[model samples]
Target: MSENMEKTIGEVGRVDWSHFSLADFLELRWRLLHDWQAVLPGGEYFGQARIGDVCYDIQIEWLADDELAVTMSPFFPHDGDSAEPPYDELVSGMPYDTQHGASLISSRRSFLELTYESFIDLAEHSILETVARFPHLQSAASKQTGFWDRHDAILCKIREQDDEDR
Candidate 1:
C-alpha cells in the first residue's frame, strides 16, 4: 500500500485557508487541482507520496476570466533531463508570474483556487450532515468550540439562517 492510501482514511478535514495569501492560495489550488486524479474518487485512498518522488506536474493556463486550462503529465523523475518529453510538455506554457505566463506550478494550491473552495464547501456540508457522527470536529469548528470561536460563530449564523429558511 502507498503512503497516500495510509494517510487517506476517513475525512481530510478543513484546511487552514487563512494561512494563505492570494498568491499562496492560487499556488495551492493549482497543486491540488493537479493531484486531483491521485486522490481516489470519493474513496479517500492515497495512491503515492509526492514528497521526494517523481510525479505528474499538473499545469494550468488562464486564458481569460477565471477559466483555467489544466494539463498533466506522467511521473518525470526530478533528475531527468529538462528537455525530456514529460518535462517539455509540462513546462510548455508561460509561467504565472509573467503577464500571460502560465500559472506557476507548485505542490500546493492557494486558498482562492477552486480546489480549496470546493474542498471547503464539501467538507462543511459533510460536517453539517454528519454533525452527530463527528461531534468533536464539528464542535471544534462550531460556536460551542471556544478554540474556533470565530468559525463556530459563523457556523452558528449559517445554521440560524438555514433554520429560518426551513
Candidate 2:
C-alpha cells in the first residue's frame, strides 16, 4: 500500500494518520520553537537541497528528551517566516521585544511526560505523515541511500561556511 514509505515494506505498510490532534501539534510546535532558540542560531537548523528540478528547504530539530521534528519546506523567494528573532538575538541572551528573558521561554511544558518509545514513535510517525502529505519528497529521495544524507552534507557545508566566516 505504500511505495513512498521510507522503509522497504514490499507495499505492505501505509501511513497512519489516525492519531492527529491539534493539541499535540501545538505542543510539539512550541517545543520546536524553544529548541530553535535554545540550540540553534536564528531559531532553525536550516539546510537546502536540490531535489529533482526543485530546491527544497529542510529543517530538523531535536527537542528535549529525544523528540525530533523534521520539516521540509519548498522555497519560494517571497515566502519566509519572520517570527523568529534575528540570528544574534536568538543566540545571544537578548530578548527581541520583551524586557526580560522569562517571556521568551513560552515553550515550556514541565507537566507533559512521554515514554522513550512514545517519543521515538512520535518522531517516526511525524516523518511518515510528512512524506505521505508530500509525495514529492519520497519521489525525490528514492534514489538516495539515506534521507538524512542531504541534511548531513548541508551541516558540513555550514561548518565550512562558519570557519570561512571567522
Give the root-mean-square deviation of each candidate in angstroms. Answer: 19.7, 13.4
Candidate 1 error regions (>4 Å): 1-22, 32-116, 143-166
TM-score of candidate 1 on Cα atoms, chains taken together: 0.24
Task: Compute each candidate's TM-score over C-alphas.
Answer: 0.24, 0.34
Best by lDDT: 2
CA lDDT for candidate 1: 0.33
Model 2: lowest-lDDT 10 consecutive positions? 98-107
Question: How many Å off is the CA of 5 in candidate 2?
Answer: 7.9
Which candidate gets the maximum TM-score versus the true structure? 2
Report the C-alpha displacement of residue 50, candidate 2, in angstroms: 16
lDDT against the true structure, each candidate: 0.33, 0.38
Tens-digit per-residue lDDT, 1-166, candidate 2: 2445445222213322233344544455555556434544323433333323223343454445444444434321111244644322222232222112111011223213543346435544544444345444344333333323444466568778899999
Measured by TM-score, how close is model 2 to the native structure?
Answer: 0.34
| Local distance difference test, candidate 2 | 0.38
